[model samples]
Target: MAATISPSSPNYHASISNTTINNLFDDSLTEIFCKLPCKSLFTCKSVSKRWLTLISNPNFHSLFLTHQHTLFQKTQALGEDLDQPSFILKPYNALVITPNSPSLQLGPLENHLSLSFLGPNFEPTNIVPQLRSVLKFVFACSNGLLVYGNPRPRHRCIYHIRNPLTKDSLELPCALTLCDHAGVLVGFTCDPYYHLETDKTKNAKVSIFSASQRRFRVVRIPAFSDTRSAFDVEVFYSETGKWKNFLVSCPKGFACGFFLTASSVEHEGKLYFMGGGRVLVYDPYENERVASVIELPRGFGEAYRGCLGVSCGTLQLSEFPISPSSAFEAYSGRVWELKHCGKGEETTTTTTTWELVHEFCLPEVVGPGFEELKANESENVKGCSRILAFHPYVRDTVFLKFGDNIICCNLLTRRFKVSKYGGLSLLFYPVIPIVIPWWPTPIPALPL
Candidate 1:
């Protein structure tokens, strides 16, 4: 753990005394050590109790997160990991996305992030007591942490906030809900900045925003029947370890099934629920009303579907033109980019701006058992074609659920491949795609 050069600089051979290392001020050591790789930091801990205390401190984690958001994320190449792939920033990211974020969509992350909580091999029975069920689906994901829930009916399941990389997890209290899972819209996000306490909105009460600002939130909008009507929303703050109810309203015009079976993703500092027809936005830091809503560029009719994702620091959406199961008949998909439009359109409820990024088709497959699958499609059975998630790195590729198998299709390559993770009676839920860092984020222990 001692990071000392021999007495002769490069040619030195004498170990530096622990006394000399401990002589440095805590701040000085922190400023220097935070820049080291996570593995090196861990090894440095055995040097002394002072090193252990410095590395384990919350303040030090905050500092480490800042460094990752800036220089560390940039130096990492796309589709490649560092020599030491054991560095991940804490969950309290403050809207600081770097340019090379596309790397998050590496080939295997979508499957791993979706199934990591079941234990090392993504087995269904590999669950913690707190994670009661065999894992229904990921509620929300930010940075590298996931809010996974059980498959109990009526949304009556427990949620566990877990960092698979670090193997750190926190069990949240039962959800405060007046409706079922289909009736609710859930999102997970952590404090973005360190100074959010003083950065509260106007002179409003800042109960939800803490000073450490390192806490995460699991927000559930239980009811959304009447448009423009206010309803109770339950939010669980990690800092206080309690669920606080707040009344908020959403933009009008969308129907009830808009957010049906949808999952939330934290983008920038806000939460986005990729609804059936439009995107429902919510900001946890401010306002009793919902944040700006974004309308999709085209229709995602009941047959075809769409999924939202972030890659290369830009908001992207992939819309399937036709169900992949119907590849034998028709095959087409589209990708769109979300961007800010020109100002002066304040009269509009949403600043609608989307550019068609890519349109692709899948190569046809000829094999046995195709006729049986096609027959199921013709009968209009349930779970025909569902888009689970967009590839985190590759924009054109997407993960789709046809029946018992989750297919990873690359629109650009026109290829189809089946994942080894199937044949289970798993719930039909959207896969929560996460771009994991080299090191895993740690779940801070909340006060009991």
Candidate 2:
């Protein structure tokens, strides 16, 4: 018996083995690679030409992104715990803003202080000018992407949506360039439902390069005041590349007076902004230009500042009462839960109200002396704190900023822990739920 040999080499007999290897590298390999964490996938891109092409393919990226989303949602639904969210300190100077490798100080529980740094491996080509101008502000973040911009006078500001994970960013034109008003508040939110298609088998390739499919929408709510009650609402939809304007009339008692000083909270597909004495809930998904106003409990006067937050799927508002007597002292704080009372009749909208759920003094909960701060300084550092953000996955917990320190407090257990670092003007924890791999990979490191 004789075997046929190819003209190029005598290895023609290995055809059967070669065919098996080729078949194994086909779709099955792609399926496994799609499930790899983004950092690992980035490393896997250099394995081989075939591997690089497969990972870089638009279809493959779409599949991977959707798979990651599905995994996050499933884990979130299962009530799993994740690491404490990291904070990005507000840039104190142009140098701080331009640094590629920035130190992320962690406020992990206990008096422990740990320091980790993000690599200077990314190029700031898209946001260099804005970052250098001292006008850049990170208005909002979703998942791991950030919405930031250079705000200018005459109602003009250049905006950008960025993803630190991928070192990519998209610049947006000034939507309010023509206006002559001040105190305009801008916010950002990412809706994957509207951004990405769940069924990757259908028209998914086009979504890979779609900016709108990858980013969030920019919302600009007019600053209503005592004299002006009506204004145009401008919303920019990333996918459509168009701005939709809606003229909204505030109810007699409801207006976003002094909204510039108060921040807006996004929960369950709505934006909550503080008004004079009530909170205005805006449903950007709704067609009408109307926003529902929820009044605060009686005696929670307009002078008291409010921070909006969401915990355990409930809208929580914390009030900080400032008084001259306690201007240099710590005072008691209050947390209120907003309850949806009843479905409105056919002709009316949904009815909502609030109830006070918890109360605690700032000094007592944070302890008389924080380990991070000096004993002498702790006594001098006495003032009410402002709520920064709530722990995304934890229950009944919120982060507060007092003087130069950041503290995490649990309302249910009445416990508090302070971050060891100071001089942080703003803080943000990247929203990706899983702990990304760090060694030899570009995935950002976390301070354990």
Candidate 3:
């Protein structure tokens, strides 16, 4: 027979006091707090003075940051199964932020850097300290460097590159002469590499800002012309810092009108882009001469419009299949594979092959469901019908419309993850709300 202890007994206080809360080593306390979900950490902060001091320490703050990033990656991987709409008809104009605490609210997007959040019903109290600006452009972020720019055309079009985390900003002098060109378009990207002998520190390269001094730097390809029947010319990233020139050189008399949508997929040690009826691959260090271009799958040119004018679609690369040898590539309209093949006699070739994996149609466009939803909204939702694409770097593909909601399709399992949100114009510029993933690294050679 054993004696039982009750909370009402005087011995309860003895038991509690005997086991000192402060006696728990710092490492043990940290491990326990780290294991708790982000929501619980907030509640635990108020539990005791010891916990409050432990949680508020800088070391713990760093741990929480790492945990938050890991959670984001995991959540993004599972986003395909979220409860999204069958057809996202409305445009998502609002910025979404994901914080460490689930109960924390997302603040407004006015003059502030908005990090993406994982929960619904955003609140205002949960905004982070570093992100407080109406971010204009995120050039590149890698390691700890984040580059961003705001085109102040009225005052010489200044481009600002800054790391929000470190609060380090480099204002690059305008690369172009204001007198020569009427307008300029600034773009940024990063390339990750692996060196056998060197440590990982030297592996990644990023192109934050480039200036066109004398001539307008345009992607040049031979046997291509500016004709209406031909595919339009666009720039793409093959390596971290290099841009590949793609010319939509359709056959001479093929009466095909091509619209261009561009997106990048990182596989193995290279980054590939799909656009204008062709897939282009680039290796940053090894292959420096030219990018290898492969023709799109049969009938891809005829299925849908090539691209959404000048507004390039999103690109997401994921480590799937649970093997280091396997990866998945996704674009706005399609998903494919970046396969490594044996080296031939003269050349070592890596090919980008499309499998025609998934095809999706918006629910609002297919039925009267959109009309009923629109009628029920507050004040008439005034927006045109258009297609929006999202590649969340994990699961399958998602397509949204200006008035329709969000719809995701799994590439490997061939299933639909249901979630819905109203859509907006397809022609609107996409807001890449997060910080640029790479910056301050050497610029990779652009494809010639």
Would you list the C-alpha lDDT of every candidate in the order shown? 0.56, 0.52, 0.36
- Candidate 3 stretches with Cα past 4 Å from truth are 1-23, 36-80, 83-147, 152-294, 302-341, 363-394, 402-404, 409-426, 431-448
Better of 2 and 3 by lDDT: 2
Estimated TM-score for each candidate: 0.63, 0.65, 0.47
Judging by TM-score, tell me the better candidate of 1 and 2.
2
The C-alpha stretches of model 2 lying farther than 4 A from their native spots are 1-37, 46-83, 90-136, 178-181, 193-216, 227-229, 258-261, 301-304, 321-329, 344-348, 368-384, 424-448
Best of the candidates, TM-score: 2
Off by over 4 Å in 1: 1-137, 154-157, 178-183, 192-212, 223-229, 256-261, 321-329, 345-350, 364-387, 391-419, 422-427, 444-448
lDDT of 1 by residue, 244-268 (tens): 8886665454333424235677877
Worst 10 residues of 2 by lDDT: 93-102
- lDDT per residue (tens digit) for residues 1-448 in model 2: 7576675775765765576534665588878875665556666778777888887776776666555555555655764332334443422211011101101111221111111121232112224333322223445554444566544445466667655444556767667544333455556665532234444566332323343234346787756665334667788776665567887665644655543236566776677767767776677766437766777777674423566766666888776543335633344667788887766567465677778887766656656574334342343344424565556546677666665566667867766666543432332211111111111111121123
Clashes of each: 8, 0, 52
RMSD of each: 9.4, 9.9, 13.2
